[model samples]
Target: MTTTFGATSTTDEVLQGVDLSGKRVLVTGVSAGLGVETARTLAAHGAKVVGAARDLAKAERATSEARAGAANGGSLELIELDLASLKSVRACADALVADGRPFDVVIANAGVMRTPFGHTEDGFETQFGTNHLGHFVFVNRIASLIAPGGRLVNVSSAGHRYSDVDLDDPNFERTPYEPMVSYGRSKTANILFAVEFDRRHKSRGVRATALHPGGIPTELARHMEPGEIERMLEQINAQAATEGQPPFQWKTVSQGSATSVWAAFVGQADEVGGRYCENCHVSSVTDGTIGIISEGVRRYALDPEHAKALWAKSEEMVGERF
Candidate 1:
């Protein structure tokens, strides 16, 4: 059946009439926003949702609603994961693997947005290290634990349109550092990670994809200066106006998280595997300088050669081969 959903669809709407009994999902960033919403929907629909976060107390508080509303054998569990640190990432992955319970879906949703320049515990650029490399090491480490026909959903962003991954200088050592540039490179890496992961695992009945949750006013923007988001919205709206399009509207948490649910469960595996998605469907490739207002994936983000190169580079950086 063709999907009846669009940009305005909510998680509740997307999961309507669906039963997730026996499904097991792991969602990162469960402390707030899209992660909580995604886990809530999955658990409410009878799926066992394992939530990972850096802050256990915060996550326990944040996921109370999901735990309270859980139904039909559905439940939520929490595990500590500090994606900013390689030691933490590996430990988390190792513990999960040792448990031997297979996950039906793994959503790499935790990430940092535009922030003042810094490096992670491992000394990589903060955004790239936390958002991309961390998950890269974690997921690939536990890849064997994903059940056949499982899905890996990497939560990327529309900001990927801002730049492609610079394999030569991933740490901004030689180039000027812009917040969005780093964010873009990281988000693009998220997509490329999915592309290559899907390629390697699809033959085993595992499919991976990346998606943008649309713009939502969540804690992801806490690092931004006051008025930064507002100014960006104005610019987006101005660009939309010039293009004869509706003004850019921020998505509610539900609306923002709908696509993740769609891609994880509702969408066809064949259609979405190895693709970049937004607005509840696979995105078409497009070229533009509309900032984040552009509505499609860049071709380079899904290039097979690029994805392969990234995979190799990632292995080298992490000092581990998948």
Candidate 2:
């Protein structure tokens, strides 16, 4: 029988009865929102959690909040990591490696959303660069230290359903860039990256998963205009109210993070790899539709040929290898 979890399930619900003592977890974007919630829940259950954030100060604040909520939150550490730059990624990884700690779970939870056109330190499109390639490079740097039987959870988004990866001109080199398109492209890459990484690394006891955290009114969308946010909420509310079905909707932060927590510790997910999930199950892929189809992965996202090509191109672009 296939079991399904929902957007309303909290991390505590997903982690109930799970023992994570002695396990080491690294969570990015842990300063606030879903990332903080994910970290707090994991640590409360006994996992040694290192909360990495772009801002150390904010991370410290998050740590205090997490500690207040966790029975075993002493393990939470705030590490500096800026996903917008390779240099920053390397520095963070180097420090972690220096600590000589092995991580049992690496949650790529940090990401940027729809924002005006911008570029990274390497001059790539901002949303695509930080949300995808930045994490890509950092994952490679830390792959060796990831526990052999560890899980790598890449927090992707359903916005991926908005568009597929653009190979011809990913960086808007030849074409004009659109904010939403760039966000969608990056989310798509997050899925494909997991597919390829799991394919290559599962043999070594490393598995990767990509998942949509469900729609939540997270700070990631802070860059968008107020009207844009309202419009989005209106659309989701309208869709849900009209459908009477589950709203196909956005979840609260705890609810949004439940699936990722489940994926990290669920017994059923232990050997599962290279799949995209939402609402705590393998997400259904619907063609030209906003709703899920109920089974199988996205064709373009899992295209082995494209995965390999993207891997190669990414390596060349970052001058790094896994």
List model 2 lDDT by residue over 1-322, tens digit each.
5445665778888887778888999999988898999988888898888888999888788668776665643367788899998899999988887888899999999999987888999888999899999999888888888988898999988778767888778888987888888988898898889889998888988899888877687788888886986776667666656656454455788898898888787835444488887777776555644533222345677677888888887887788777
lDDT of 1 by residue, 211-297 (tens): 999989899999888898889888888888888888888899999999999999999999999999998989999887645666899
Clashes of 1: 0
Best by lDDT: 1
Note the Cα lDDT for every prediction shown.
0.93, 0.81
Residue pairs with clashing backbones, model 1: none
Clashes of 2: 1
Determine which window of 10 residues in candidate 2 has minimal summed lDDT: 288-297
Each model's RMSD to truth, in Å? 0.9, 2.5
TM-score of 1: 0.98
Instruction: Tell me the spans in candidate 2 whose CA falls farther than 4 Å from its real position.
Output: 1-4, 72-74, 236-249, 291-297
